[model samples]
Target chain A: MKTRLTGRVWKYGDDVNTDVIFPGKYTYSIADPREMALHALEDLDPGFVAAVRPGDIIVAGKNWGCGSSREQAVVCLKEAGVGAIVARSFARIYFRNAINQALPIVTCDAVDGVENGDEITIDFAAGTVKTPRRVFTFPPLPAEVLEIIEDGGLIPHVRKQLGR
Target chain B: MGKTFAEKVLAQKAGLQQITAGQIVTVKPDRLLTHDNTSAIAATFRKIGVARVADPSMNVIVLDHVTPAANETYAISHQATRAFVAEQEIAAFYDIGEGICHQVLPEKGHAWPGAVIVGSDSHTPTAGAFGAFAAGIGRTEAAAVMATGEIWLRVPESIRVQLHGTLPARVSAKDVSLYLIGLLRADGADYCSVEFAGEAINAMSVGERMTLTNMSAEMGAKNAVVEPDEKTLAWLAGRVTQPFAPVYADADATYASVIEMDTTTLAPQVACPHTVDNVAPITEVAGKRVDQVLIGTCTNGRLEDLRAAAEILRGKHIARSVRLLILPASREILQAALAEGIITDLIAAGATLLNPGCGPCLGAHQGCLAPGEAVLSTSNRNFKGRMGSKDAAIYLGSPATAAATALTGVITDPREV
Candidate 1:
């Protein structure tokens, strides 16, 4: 996993559920990650995909990814080249899915003052996120969780163990 | 400290003598439930390079969401699910018209006490009604479960909710749940397990208790459970033939928090448009015009819920401007309603009876809301675009309230009607 990251921020409010993140209507019809990326945040922010650049960061309020356990939600963001998600909190299943997919998600209170398009820097090991005006800190990821991300997600990690 | 219900269940499943909140352990679920999501899960399962399912008998797939092939996409998805079931030789598959996965599982004796169940859908936690430890997982994790029969989980801290006093005549368990959601806020129980207790819970029937557990997802609960007792066993006597391991928390179980609610004065509640936690008392929002009324879902689609709606619609006429739709949760409940004349009464009152499935709830098909419309429904969610149109609005209410809204063509209080 990348230890240092910088990106322009895209902000959203609380309770950004899975349905809006990646609507259920396309879950079965669309299988490719990049195709699903086109619809990412379409429901909540219609211009999201158009505005999003690769390696951009999403700064959101609490309870991000609150509804439905669709891995597609995480896949969409990863495919769009989102560097990391910084939110005050996240729904549990989404949090686990992000780690398993090697998407960097940080929890921090600095999400409050972060503006859209603000340049931000994140240090995963140091548990610190630096915005234009302030710095926010979160607890470092558990070693086990970091190991999985470092090995390029759980699937690759397991594959390496089996030497496949 | 003594263990909560969640702690005890995880410890037992992990084969550990003791555990605490936040402890991570691997568990082999007794059952893995799936609905429309099974189509996507099948794709992921194949990607894992598993030639055969780890345990075909343990996987239960139900065709509920967008059932009967609402469109070409859904039809193809259903075909994939049927093929997967046939290939895996899964015995517990439910076809279209059978019912919603959550309701059918319990009706068919699959969910039981002391078992750990995971599903690919969010409301899988509904199985906690039978005192089981159940939670929702994503497709990849579900595929891992199918491939290895094992998955990892972190034990969640428990919030003990004590429901006291009697509900008013016009109010029911749906009102109780909506009120609780308002009090707990949307993410109040995030990543935590909730256990319902107290005299009010003791007095509720098993069907009624399910509402409490079913809506726990609205509060972001990992799972919700009601401890099994006589009512639970009585409800299971004929339905569940296999013996089940019944586990309960110790008498002195410690909880992260305890909330004691008095329902005696609780009014019928409704979660307003755009969010489940944006709840308001019925009196405040009454007379707001509605375009539709839906009286079923996993949350409030049981027999008792139908009865509640039927009582209000009996011999009464629905507003001509309103499109009233009633869907029973399962075939068994639908049949029971028909036998009791609830179905006839609802139709006589100008309601349209849709098939027993979840198409309309999640905006897949059936009774979809047009843009700028408002609907009062018994379903769990009211998120934007939840019922097909982002510009439309959805209000979550009890069946009684839904019936009343159908009659008035507005969000009216059942008590006032």
Candidate 2:
């Protein structure tokens, strides 16, 4: 599935870990998308919750989610309505977690070019990213990786594999 | 082709003995665990339109990061986790008062030898202490595990860290681990399973082994595994319900790389500010001045760790200029320390005791550093701005070194203490 992100890009510096992604304290809050949404990036970027818009992608540097393998990190990103994340490098777990949740974690070297709020389109199938100013092509995901994303992460994929 | 730990584990889980590169091997996790920080993984299942977790008994959720509600936001987050656990019927939902996931998980026996354990936190690899090929996965991957109990991976290569010589009385496994981290650099073991095999490792207690494996993530390695022995089995008897046996790589087992460490004359090592790779002999930074000395976290917050710090703290008070926060990783750990009077001695000597949790480790609350302040911490991760302020400097060391630093108010060798 292809989705377009239209909000201002909320830029963050390097090593945005699970602690900063969703601080440990908020993990106990209600699963109501709004409550979970309110605390997104509360520690690293206090204004992140108020500043983000649905479908905005976060651009990060190497080793994104470097510390703590907390899954709440990804939940906060998804609940904050982040459509996709593009980074130069990602912690192994965060990379797979984002894709399995179908949150669209893509890797690109030119992330430094995309400023906050630059209207962009990420076409999963085309393996390309579009900014009004430039059309950037990303390396296509491997077939298996794409299959998992298309199946909406591992659960659905496993269900299909199991024919349940 | 030679198989890596990740390859062998995945192949077994996928019901196959071998899988080729570029092929998808859907791996069924033998155990799944997460803390409050990444509970969002279970939420990802909802986003993808799935229902209950794949298996309640096999999955566990823990509230570790924000223990005791450092802020209103923390309070709210804890509530969200409770709701998720109750709604999903996840059997092993450890609440805020429970303790750090890393310490409590192994204590409770969720991780077993030869199992493939996954978690949302990078440090999940600490389970490798049990001889499991444990790795950290992302929330979405965790969500997939929650929904279907499986995910795919490209098995990583293996790196053998061979240690020789006996550990000095003052030196513990933390010193050895820091020494290795210093030598290998933070990214030295990246994406590889670091197999620790040596007299020093086998002779160390399970607590020390856990401390070693717990910090494997600091080196950016997938995990650290010990060839489980009597010490491991003793601990596992009361905790693990699953049937298992210790698994070790064969003597002729292939490795992507090998690094040798000789500890006969090794001195106490310290990971200085900004990065865990920052290393220096504790003597070099001593008496420079310190603002805080934190003694807890998943890495080195157990009773034995606290005792090691307290033994050094006995008869010596923390410098008036230094604030020492002594947080055990769990309630049982706290009890052990208290029962042994370690906490009282530490407290009487000017150490502040906090609850058992992952405080200060993430800089969210408790023992944060101010700009220009320096802290000697027993916890893992010494990144810039990691504690509280970006300008603050952190020195990572063993509990003994951390205790010694508290007395001198800067990094120092325990031998001199």
Candidate 3:
């Protein structure tokens, strides 16, 4: 697992719920992550699907992923090749689901200074993100949480621990 | 030192001598709930290369989200679930038209005091009303639990919500929940366990308490619990056969914060469009024209909720310009309403009754809104595009408020009626 990532930014406001991340109506019909990727953020920004480049990161305000506990919301972002998500705060379930899916997310209050399309590099292990102009620091993840991320998620981590 | 209800429950489940906030621990819950998306979970479980569920009897599956096959895809999903249930020999399985999972699980004795329950749906905390530790997990987590019978959790700090004073006539559990949501600010209690106490909460019926726990997720609570007492025991008398002891917070239990709410002065409240935290008193948003009124969900679909609506709509018809849709939370509740004539009273008052399931609530199907319409709902959540169209607006209120709005074709205050 890579601890360093560089990507373009896609900025979003507060309370970006699961409904906009991946619509509820599509819950049943979609299963493939690539198929789910096509509709990611479709409701909030219709052009997001087309404009999003691989390795683009999402920078959001407080309470990002604040609706249903749908893992598809995290899956879609990972499938769409989102490098990482940086938000001021996160709804608890989304934060956990992202960890389960091995999606990198950082909480930084300075997200407001990062503009859309700004090229940024993040050293997750160092808890620092740098833009062309400045650097922002977030608390490093707990050692156990980092272990799960390094193993590519809980499923794999459990497998390794169980020696299965 | 005293332990909070969540701390006590997690400690027992984790087989630890003691546990505190922020410590990560693994627990095998007494029950795991998956509804509507059981097929997806089954697929995930198989993909994980697990031979079989760790304990089939510990898992309960329900078909309520899009029952009666809204489309071929849903029908196929249901078929897959049936096959999976048969293959796994799952102990409890509720088919279509049975009822919503949150309602049926407790009705069938899956919830009890001091029990730890996790479900795939966000509203799983509804069972916490029984003094149990219940929370929601995502599909992959559910699948992982199915395989190993255990999941990890970071112990949450507890918040004490003391309810004092009596509720006004027009005010119901729905109002209390919305009022709390306003104070919690959507993320005020995020990642924390909420413990309900005081006179008002003790005086509330089991159904009312369920409403409170169900909406705890709206404020991002990890779980919501009410300590079981004589009232709780009485409600669980015949409904639950399992033997369990109640867990209570110690007097000296450390708490993150304490919030006190007096219900006597509380009036009917509504959560305005786009966000649940966007709430205001009924009087402030009254007179906004409504195109539809929906009364039911896992949140407010119990028998007491339907009876409240029937009382308000007894002889009066809904406004000609307004559409009213009623859904009972469970099949048993629907049958009880039919016997009590609550269903007839609602229909006679011009309300359309839909099958017992979660269709319109999640914008899946059944009474979807047209663009630019406004609706008053008794269900939880009013996010933009929640009920089909982003252009439409949503107002969440009590069943009484929904009934009043149905009759007047506007966001009329229940008290005014």
TM-score: which candidate is best?
3
Q: Return whichever of 1 and 2 wins on TM-score.
A: 1
| Model 2 alpha-carbon drift over 4 Å, by segment | A1-65, A70-89, A101-140, A150-164, B1-5, B19-23, B37-42, B48-51, B87-89
Tell me the deviation in Å of residue A136 in model 2. 12
Write one digit per residue (lDDT tens) for candidate 3, span B112-154. 9999999999889999999999999898888889988998888
Report the Cα lDDT for residue A99, model 1: 84
Candidate 3 recovers a fraction of native contacts equal to 0.52
Instruction: Put down candidate 3 lDDT per residue, A31-68, tens digits, no spaces.
Output: 78999999899889998888888899998988899889
Q: Choose the strongest candidate by DockQ.
A: 3
Per-residue error for B56 in candidate 1, Å, reads: 1.4
Candidate 1 lDDT tens digits, B93-191 = 999999999999988888889989999888988899899999988877787788878888889989999999988898988889989889888889999
Report residue B165 deviation for candidate 3 (angstroms): 0.2
Q: Write the per-residue lDDT of candidate 2 for residues A55-120, one digit (tens) a residue.
A: 788877666776665556676788888888877777666666676667777777536667766766
What does chain B score (TM) in every candidate?
A: 0.99, 0.96, 0.99
* lDDT, candidate 2, B77-189, per-residue tens: 67777888888777787777678898888888887777888877778878888788788876556665777766666667778887899988788888888888787766567
Which regions in candidate 3 have their CA more than 4 angstroms from the true location?
A: none
Q: Using Cα atoms with residue i matched to residue i, what is each candidate's TM-score against the true structure?
A: 0.98, 0.83, 0.98
